[model samples]
Target: ELEALADPMRKDVSVVRKRIDVVNKELKPLGTNVQKKEKEYKDALDAFNEKNKEKVQLINKLVELVGESERLRMKKLEELSKSVDSMQ
Candidate 1:
C-alpha cells in the first residue's frame, strides 16, 4: 500500500515539473518581446522630443524676425513724416 501511494505522488511531482518547464519556455520569448517593444517606444519618444525642440527653435527665430521687421517699418515711417513736416 505504501509503495502504491509513493508511486502516484512521484508521478504527480513529475507532471508538475514538466508543466513548470513548459511555462518557463513560453515565458522567455514573451519577456524578450516585451523588451523589444519597450525599446521601440523609447526610440519613438526620443525622436518626437528632438523634433519638438527644433520646432520651438524655428518659432523663436520667426518671432525675432517679425519684431525686427516691425521696428524697421516704424523707423522708415518716422523718417517719412519728418521729411513731410520740413517740406510744409
Candidate 2:
C-alpha cells in the first residue's frame, strides 16, 4: 500500500520537473531578447538627444541673425528720416 501511494507522488514530481525544465528553456531566449531591446532603446535615445542639441543650436543662430537684421534695418530707416527732415 505504501509503495502504491509513493508511486503516484513520484510520477507527479517527475511531471513538475519536466514543466520546470520547459519553462527554463523558454525563459533563456527571453533574457537575450530583453538585453537586445535595451541596447536598441539606448541607441535611439542617444540619437534623439544629439538631434535635439543640433536643433537648439540652429534656433539660437536664427534668433541672432534676425536680431542683427532688425537692428541694421532700424538704423537705415533712422538715417533716411534724418536726411528727409533736413531737406524739408
The candidate maximizing TM-score is 2
TM-score of each: 0.81, 0.86
Candidate 1 residue lDDT tens string, 38-79: 999999999999999999999999999999999999999999
Clashes of each: 0, 0
Clashing pairs in 1: none
Give the C-alpha miss distance for residue 12 in model 1, angstroms. Answer: 4.0
Clash number for model 2? 0
Models, CA RMSD each:
1.9, 1.7
Off by over 4 Å in 1: 4-11
Local accuracy by lDDT, each model: 0.97, 0.96
lDDT of 2 by residue, 1-88 (tens): 8887768688788899999999999999999999999999999999999999999999999999999999999999999999999999
